[model samples]
Target: MKILLTAINSKYIHSNLAVRYLKAFTKDLDCECTIKEFSINDRIEKIFEKIIEEKPNVVAFSCYIWNIEYVVKLSNLIKILDEKIEILYGGPEVSYDGEKFLSQNPGEYLIVEEGEETFRDFIEWKLGIGNLKINNIKGLYYKNEKEISFDGERKPMDLNKTVFPYEKDDELHNKIVYYESSRGCPFKCKYCLSSTTHGVRFMDVSRVKKELQFFIDKGVKLIKFVDRTFNCNHRFSMDIWKFLIDAKTDATFHFEISADILTDEEINLLNTAPKGRIQLEVGVQTTNNEILKNIDRNIKFEDIKEKVLRLEKNRNIKQHLDLIGGLPGETFDMFKKSFNDVYSIAPEEVQLGFLKLLKGSSMRFETEKWGMVYSPYAPYEILSTDSISYDEILKLKRTEEVVDKYYNSQKFGNILKYFMPKFESPFDFFFKLGTYFKNKGYLDRNISSADYYRIFMDFTEEILNENTEILSEIIKYDYLKFNKKKWLPTFLNRVVEKDIHKKIRTELKKENIEDVHVERFDIDILKYEICGEIVKDTKYVIFDENNEDNIKYFE
Candidate 1:
């Protein structure tokens, strides 16, 4: 028998650890097992053709909320091509509704919950290894005569017994490899699936260290920990972090952590690590205490803020702070306050996301009680609630776009810092900018970086009554720092005499600078103090291609 464990990821950069794990665990089975991955952007016909070409007797799909609909359509098409092909579906999306999903979609088996042991047993039965009947397999749902029947819930597998999925796959070296030190979450946040499971089961620290060494040896770019709350067990998290830090690989590890739970020692440890070596995604869903209580999140806003600020002080770790727009008892004004509060901390990235009422989450069951109305589809995003209307949600959507483009992009940080105090709050500034884009019909259009700068200049001058020339010069300075190719917008450009270029070039050459270009702008370079002090009238901004850090001014 031949088996193919596959998944359709949302993007090509993502490698599905689920399918890889299934294949690794079933390696002992007497069959030709392979892992095939595709992106959702691929044509269904092409995917079906590839599967048919493989001609596997068994095909198991790792489903998720993002790819469930696409999987269903593709699976149905596959069944039409070959009815004899035994199709199977598993993953969080179908784990709760396995019966209903199997009944409607094209699949004969649905493995629910921890699939390592269950999949191994099912594959053994398919390969006829022993008298192990299908009914004996726990965590499996199959058709018995006319009705779908399931074996009882399966116990979580011992992580020590599971094989590392990346042991054999060479292609994963350049992709974002996901690693987990533990299973299940300690907290019961109402909106998360992790709340349904109890107790955290950690993989052996020795095993985790070995895997980290393997990934480090491979020189993978990123290893994102899939653990719900990576810092729930402080010792386990620290042990892993220490191992990675000691190894000192160029690989960057990403983790989703609770800020309030971080210890001073852990913060210091992170502080000493190399810059950009580690990234933390801290989810500050909302700053409203009432809403936090309603959701059963055991975190004080002040405490989280202090911890986040402490981490920021280190300046080594890249912090990605998150805020969910729609939550229970959160009005527009309250959300604006939440936004302003999170934005004040100055995280590297502020991800303003909406609440998704996922299946099997406590929030989904209490939608009516909380006056929440959501889309009845995969990734069930909240449309409105008693405190916030649909129109307000629409406005927040636009505000989210503006935040992503401006503040989150890190392009207008200095400009925003200078002008944010002009408004009542950061939220007010973003909201007004979002409205400006909507009025100008630029909200839904594709905008270049130059166009974004121009739009921001217009907003500052026409609406906020700020000096556009000063803002333009600051933007030009910022733009030139990242982009080596010397090009300035018309508003920012100033004519430089040939003699001035020659004089600056000579000075740069004396300083052992290479690939230096001189540009003139109508702004006091001394006033725009970036890194070093500018002590004289700066008519020209000298840009060095080889060294981005070598930006200087010459009169």
Candidate 2:
């Protein structure tokens, strides 16, 4: 019999680690097995054609919230094309409500919780190995003659027994490879599905080190750890960090960590690592203590703040901080305070997200009790609550857009740092900027990078009444840093005599500056400030070819 394990990923850059794991576990089963992956962006007809071309007897789909609806429709289409094709579905979206999913969809099997052992048993039974009975397989739900039956819960697999999913497949080379040093989460934050599972099981440190070396040897660009809290065990995490430092590959490892749980030793290790070697995603959902308590989140906001501030001091490690807009008992004002608090830390990126009431999460059950109303779709994002109305949420959504475009993009860092202090709070600055964009219809229209620069200039001149020349110079510097070409915005293009460049280069030669390109501008050399210190603009911006760190201006 032929078997196919497939997944519809959210993006092309993502590879389905689940399907790979299933195929790896059932590799020795006396059946021909293959793995196929497609993105949701792919046309359904094309996916249908590809699957039909495979002509497998058993087709197992690894489902998730993002791709469940598509999988259901595709399964129905496949059944129509060939009723003999056995259909199976499993993942967090269908694992909780297996019976309902089977009743509504065309799938014949649902593997719950840990699927490695259960899938192996089911495949063996289908291939008629050793008179194996499907009913005895734990963590499996199957439909037989229109009757849905389930086995008991399956025990979690020992990580040591599981083989590494990557098997020298050339397709995985350029994708964002996801690695798991550990399974399950230690903390039970109510909104997360990981909270439902108890205890954390780690793979053997030697196994993890081998896997890290494999990816590094492959020259993979990024390897994101799927561990819920990567730093939950400091020893395990630090060992991996040390291994990466020793390996010295160009690959960057990304981790989701709890800031409050980080030790000083771990901080020092991260601080000394090579720049861009590691990136951290710290979720500071909300700063409201009452909401944090209601959600059973054990984070101390003050401790998190202190730890994050220390992490920010490490120029090598890039940190991305997160804040959720909607949560229990959080009003708009309270959320603004939360936003302002997280914004003060100055992470490399600030991800403004809304609360998603996911399936099987404790927070989903408490929606009614907390007076929360959310969308009843796959993602189940919150629409409103008793404290925060829908209109307030909409306003926050606009503020989120501004934060993503301006603050998180890192393109406007200098100007934002300069202008944000003028407002009552950072939230006030972003909220007003969001409002300005909405009023000018820029929010609804398509905008280019150059247009964004022009819009920022207009905002500074008309709304904030700040010095446009200084703002333009800051933006020009930012543009040069990000963009490769020497294109300037129309407003910033000023005619300068050739003698000005000659004079600046002559002055720079005395300072031992060589191999530099000089451009003259219209701004006053002596009056402007760069990075909070008065510096001569000289109308001459010097770019040294060898040194990116040395961007000099001469009067």
Candidate 3:
């Protein structure tokens, strides 16, 4: 039998580890199994054509919220075109409500949670072609002419025995590959599907090292651990970290860690890691006490702040912080506080996302209790709650784009630093800036890189009276540091004595300084950089352009 295990991924750079695991587990079976992956961005008709070209007897799709709608439509078309082709569905989207989904979709069977064992057993016994036997194949809902029935749930497997899923390392180059050293999670954050399961299971440290070595050898650019909380077990996490630190491969390893619980040993070990070796994504969903309780996410804001700050001091590992906008108890005002709290940490990246009331999660069942309304479809993102209005959420949605372009993009770091203190709080500054962007229709269309500076300047003139030129100076310094462009933007081009560059170039050469690219500003950029206080003086900023750390100031 020819079986095709398909994956509709969210992006071209993302590889679906689930489909790979399915293929790996059933490797020894009699069936000729092939794995086919496509992006959700692909046209539905095109994907259908590709799937039909495979000419498989059985087609199984690894479903998820991002691509379930497309999968269901494709399944219907496949069944309509050729009834002889058998279809199977599995993954988080269908595992929770197999009965309702089975009644609606065209799939002949549904493989519930932890499908590696269940799918193998189904193939061994019988597929839809032969006998429709719904015997003791654990974690499956089989459909017959009479009705659809589900077998019992499957038990979780030992992490040590799970085979390495990625047989094709050549496909992972320059892509964001996913790896899992563990399964299940310790925390019961109600919003997450992980809360449905209990206990954490980890793979053996030695085995994990060997698998990582495989990726390093293959030149995989990134490997993001899918473990719910990578740092839950200090010993296991530390062993993995130590191996990576000692091996010192060029590939970057990323982990989603619970920062508040980080031990001093973990912090010290991570500190010693070579730059670009490790990146951490810390979820600080919110700092609001009421909202945290409502979601059953137990974390102290102070402890998170302390640990993140300690890690930031080392400057080796890059941290990306997350904040959710529309949690149950987080009103617009309350979310502002949460935003400011995370902003105080000064992470390298800030990801502002809305709460997703996913299926199989405890929070999804309690939506009525909280007066929450979400889209009646896959990826049920919260629209409004009793505490927050839909209009307020819309504003927050617009604000997210502004943050991505300005703050998260890291292009306006110095510009934000010079102007953020002028407002009440970080949230207020961003809120007002987003409002300006919305009013001017700048958000409606794509703004060029230079136009972004001009838009911000116009917004500043509307709000503040003076200090526009100083803002331009800050932007000029930021832009020069960004790229190797010799010409400045029209608005940013400043007047200076014609011989200034020659004199500065001669001075740098005389002092044995390698960088000759320099610019003079009327204000004391060096003193203002140290303390926020602006000191007036004729200052020359020697720009290395290539290295930010090499930037120096001359009086």
RMSD after CA superposition, every candidate? 2.3, 2.7, 2.7
The sequence of per-residue lDDT tens digits that candidate 1 reaches over residues 212-310 is 888888788899999989998889888888887777688899999999999988998888888888999998999988899989998888999999999
Report the Cα lDDT for residue 542, model 3: 82
Distance from true location, Cα of 198 in model 2, Å: 0.8
Q: What tens digits encode model 2's per-residue C-alpha lDDT throughout 166-230?
A: 87665667799998989999999999999999999999999899888888878899999999999
Error of 2 at 293 (Å): 0.6
What number of clashing residue pairs does each candidate have, in the order they appear? 0, 2, 0
Q: Which stretches of candidate 3 lie over 4 Å from their true place?
A: 126-134, 494-520, 536-542, 545-549, 553-555
What TM-score does candidate 3 get on C-alpha atoms? Answer: 0.92
* Residue-wise C-alpha lDDT for candidate 3, range 204-304, written one tens digit per residue: 88899999999988888899999999999999999999999898578899999999999999999999999989999999989887678889988888889
Per-residue lDDT of 355 in model 2: 91
Please provide TM-scores, in order, for all candidate models, with all chains considered together.
0.95, 0.93, 0.92
- What pairs collide in candidate 2? 525-537, 525-538
Candidate 2: misplaced stretches above 4 Å?
A: 465-467, 494-517, 521-530, 533-536, 544-550
Write down the lDDT of every candidate, Cα atoms only.
Answer: 0.84, 0.84, 0.86
